[model samples]
Target: MREYEYHAPLSLERLFELAEAEGMEVRFLAGGTDLMPRISAERNQIPRDRKPPMRIIYLGGLGLDEVTDDGESVTIGATASLSALLDNGAVRTKLPALHEALREMAGVSVRNTATIGGNIMNASPAADSVPPLLVLGAECLLRSAAGERRVALSEFFTGPGKTVARPGELLVSVTVKPGRGGSAFRKLGRRKAETLSVVNAAACVELRDGLCESVRIAVGSAAPVVVRCTGAEQALVGKKIDENSVREAGALVVKALSPIDDIRSSAWYRARVAPTMVARALLAAAERKRG
Candidate 1:
């Protein structure tokens, strides 16, 4: 990395103060998994020109580093690591689908270093957290010298590795509502672990009075962003979970995807499987009612 000053503020306010003065020149450092690799590459590319100070705002010390319940919903601190959530009971009880997604994310070692906030902030098109969290209807908390804003997780992502986070603002936490439903997450990657997801998804549904009371389905890597299938969901929102409704809903899901042909997989293949994934997830949710 190039030469520059480094400051590790013990508090968020101080971090904001430093950030207000530096702007883009200041990159908040959390876990440093993505930034460190980029920094290393930048240094190698420019041996002559002095690189910018790997000016990092250490998120490790930030007080927002745990998962907690607030009666109605769960708040995940920005610095909460994946490994930490692997064993959190409340999380497992309320949202095992997310835990299932995490367990299969990357590998154990990478999970140890990857933070929930970083994954959301990075907004990778193939990020495992995005699809499940989208299905869970999560929101993000951002803080900066100007103030704090609560943005829906769906709105937080702008594109690949991009977000609405402004200068001096750092992601503080994520909030998810408490829910009782069956949810499932699946990913298609080049390898079993530590691989990019070619496509991934999460489905959640609840039945009341033998009719689907609510349903949320989200798919990723099949579009520019993780998208909830409002149309498909509408098909199941009030109907009983039956073979015909599910078959039709699955078709709706197929219409929702907009995958692209790439080295990992083809758009046609992704389109074909998207509905199958959604149907399976819905079936999983419906089976819970019988048990």
Candidate 2:
């Protein structure tokens, strides 16, 4: 790895100051699970170009690792480890979809070090946490020296590895209101453990007297960004959720996706399996709602 300056700022102010320091290229370090591998790959570039020495700001000291449930909403600090969230009672009971996503992510060791902020900021379409967050109606809280702002998680990502966050901004936390419905997450990968998702899906359903009262569906790895299947959601809302209705709604998911062929799977394969994955998630969510 290339030599870089490392700083562990104890406060957000110090972080911003370090970020604004001229002549130094600044990169924030959360869990380093994703950033470290990418940095190591840079060493193998055939034609290495001269670049500014990087300054790595470690976020651990900034106290951004708390998980709080305020009855109305659950706010998860960005730097909180995936394992920490998995152990939270509010997450397991109130956010089962997210809990399942965390459980299926990587393995125990990786989860101990991987941060939710890093996962979201990485902005991978196949990110395990994103689909559930999208379905749960989560919001990202971004902070900077100037001020702070909140962006809907569904609207956060512009494309792979891209978000609306401005330069000098840091994602502070994510907030999601606990819903009175059931939500589920499903991931399709090459194997079961420690595999990147070929297609992943999440669904939230609220039933009233055996009729779907509200619904949300999101599919990952099927588009440039994780996307909500609004058309499918509209079709399912106010309708009875049965095998046929669920299957029909799942079909609508394909219309919103523009998948691409990659190492894990092909565009055709993704397109084929995405609908079924979504259908399964919806069915599971509906069953949970019934219970």
Candidate 3:
């Protein structure tokens, strides 16, 4: 790494002013989990107008930490640490699917250092938080000196490592309405822990009379952006839970995914495994409903 000037902005306004003024030359310093690696990686170096890469605007000092529930919705601050989410009782009870993914993310040391905002901002295709958030139908609050804007979680990502957030905007927090439905998150990785996902999925199902009243399914690492499987969801709407209904829904999910061949797994393999994963998630959600 090269020496660079660091600015510790206490609030969102200051952060936006710096970012808008600096433009592409300025980078937000959230957890530094993704930022540091991009700078030091031997294969691809940060495009520096000079030697030190770019200036970092540190977000660590910002007083943005909060997790609140008003019984209507939950607002999670962008700066909230992954470690904090894992230990939060309200999160475990209310958003168990999301919390389960957070707890299973990387390892204790890495989870300690990674921030939820960083994860969303980086816009990684395989990010652990994306699928769960997508399934929950969360909304992100993006703030800049100009104003604050809110976007649905499904509309957040434009591409891998890219977001619709403007140059001056910083993600302030994410909000999700409390649901009475059961949800599940499942991923198939190269190994158990700390490995990037090859196929990952999350689903939320509102059950009535042992049939799906409403359904939302999201899959990651299978496309340029995290995808919401509306086709699969439509298939399950008002359909009774059975082997045939489940199998048909799973097939629709497989067809909806845009899996590509990669070193981690082949497109064929991803296609085969995706439906099974979705099936598994459905079963898990059903179990939650029963319990």
Candidate that scores best on lDDT = 2
Error of 3 at 44 (Å): 8.9
Evaluated with TM-score, which candidate comes out highest?
Answer: 2
What value of lDDT does candidate 2 attain over all alpha carbons? 0.92
Model 3 TM-score?
Answer: 0.93
Query: Which 10 successive residues of model 3 have the least lDDT summed?
Result: 42-51
Q: Which stretches of candidate 2 lie over 4 Å from their true place?
A: 1-3, 44-47
Q: Between 1 and 3, whose lDDT is larger?
A: 3
Better of 2 and 3 by lDDT: 2
Give candidate 1's root-mean-square deviation (CA, Å).
Answer: 2.2
lDDT (10s digit) by residue, model 3, range 1-291? 355667898877677777765324678887888888876683266545455336679888886768998987889989888998888877888887889789778888988989889888999888988888888889999988878889999899999899999776788899988488888899899999888899888888889988889988888889888898898999999987566777889999876778889889998998898888888887787678767
Tens-place lDDT per residue, model 1, 3-117, is 6557888887788777865323777777777677877777668477654454667877767888889778989998888988887886787776688789888898888888888
Deviation (Å) of 242 in candidate 2: 1.5
Error of 3 at 76 (Å): 0.4
What's the TM-score of every candidate structure? Answer: 0.91, 0.97, 0.93
Question: CA RMSD for every model?
Answer: 2.2, 1.2, 2.2
